[model samples]
Target: MPGPIWTSPAPPGNPAARRAPPAGRFRSWWNSCCKGRAEPSRHTGGIVAPERVDFYVLNQADDASRLGYACMIAAKAWRQGHRVYMQVDTPGEAEALDRMLWEYQAASFIPHARTGTPEAALSPVLIGTECAPEKWRGMLVSLTRALPEGAAECRRVADLIADSQDHRAAGRERFRAYRAMGVEPGTHEIRL
Candidate 1:
């Protein structure tokens, strides 16, 4: 499958540019997530009200490596007793990750179920192309170029950026969008 092109504010003439949710809806989502807690910001020199999001830039360029790293992160989070949501761009990617989690590491096992599955509510990890704030929480591992809906409700959001020019550019756009939304997103550069 071709990698996703991530651009925010959608470049002119690009039909795939994602339109953000309406301001009212976005504000409601943000409010519900933050619950009026003010987050401290060093750059702004004042309290900024927004949920935290993290962007991970992988050193490997292949899809397998990116998905593997995502699994690693999700496994770690699950072990830490946090519910995890692994958001992909398509159902195929979701299925691929589901298969990967079972065998990604020989000695490790991460309990996960696809969204809408009967076991998803009880599983520590839920994989899907969309977010389910009501069922999934804790950490969100986003594999898509665009920010997954309802990300603000999660305790932390991780946007994975593959080692490719297009992926990096899209990651930057996501970073900008998060910042604009008053959320400070940290970048993680993965060496492996």
Candidate 2:
């Protein structure tokens, strides 16, 4: 079950065209074809394309506060003409965010739908546990502890870190992860 024997090809005008190919001259064509191809490195493909990550570390320990802040960021991004993708920890969180999007701003609401829904394709903002779709390549507001799987696609990422000790630890881990991915994350203290 070996690949085809790769006979060396000669130029049309070369007199060597009639000569037999030498031993080892039949090297695997596949290997030569793939030579110099770079592979994804240990550091998330070694930051194949560096990303701009900003960590928003809130002063409050309440989980709801983090989500609320995420709502604000998503809304702002939507208004700025950027497609926003909200990455949550669970479907429960996605639902909660969907509800908050309607009430967070009181008079106005950020139009958004869950990841798989058809409306998500047209909406400026999308919320879900899954990775952001290829088209939704704007800012990704992450509410999860670990980095979102589709983070590499987004040009900018906003990671909300709650003030609790556990949340802080998780945030630190994510910080290191982004660094490993070739991005130096910026930290901003959120007072609200």
Candidate 3:
């Protein structure tokens, strides 16, 4: 059995409340995630880069719940025959994600890396205190070795992490440029 990484957020002694696991919380999250946002309309837009599927998580009231949703979405996409890239902060978190992915019988694990020192191209999706890439590699290797099977599947998880890193880098660039241009934050209407 996997060790527990989460605590329920429901108030104690609430008989009417459902004590839902991580997956259950995803339902409410997917709904309010973009509340009051304009729905992007369909148009005859020219062929552009394959639309990158994204789930933006600023912070989570329930971290496990958020992670559960992220794992589910990526697994679903993989089932649909799309390549997936998953990223999580720690090896333990990655283990949880790997378990979820394996439940779907996707690919096995492989190293997801770029050439040069790991630090030179370390994943940006890895948030919090700085750790050498070697340390990361060691943790990941140890965790995957303990798995019963599905090494390739772990690679898919890593791919999603890479995707998150790419997304984060793009966001940083946009924000930096926006600040440099002295554009006031918030949506603006322009008659282009």
Candidate whose lDDT is highest: 2
- Candidate 3, residue 87: how far the Cα is off, in Å: 1.4
In model 3, where is the ten-residue run with the lowest total lDDT?
138-147
Instruction: Give all TM-scores, in the order shown.
Output: 0.72, 0.74, 0.29
Top TM-score: which candidate number? 2
lDDT of 2 by residue, 8-94 (tens): 476555778668475455342112211111443344555553246889999999878988999888877776667777888888989
Q: Over 4 Å off in model 2, which ranges?
A: 1-46
**Ranking of predictions according to TM-score:** 2, 1, 3
Residue by residue across 1-192, what tens digits does model 3's lDDT show?
A: 996553556545575336544445444212322212132212213221111112133332344444555555544443343333344445566566555544533454222232233632443222211222322221111111121122111211121112234444643453344334333223212111
Question: Which has the higher TM-score value, candidate number 2 or candidate number 3?
Answer: 2
Off by over 4 Å in 3: 1-53, 58-60, 102-192
Decoy 2 TM-score against native: 0.74
Ranking by lDDT: 2, 1, 3
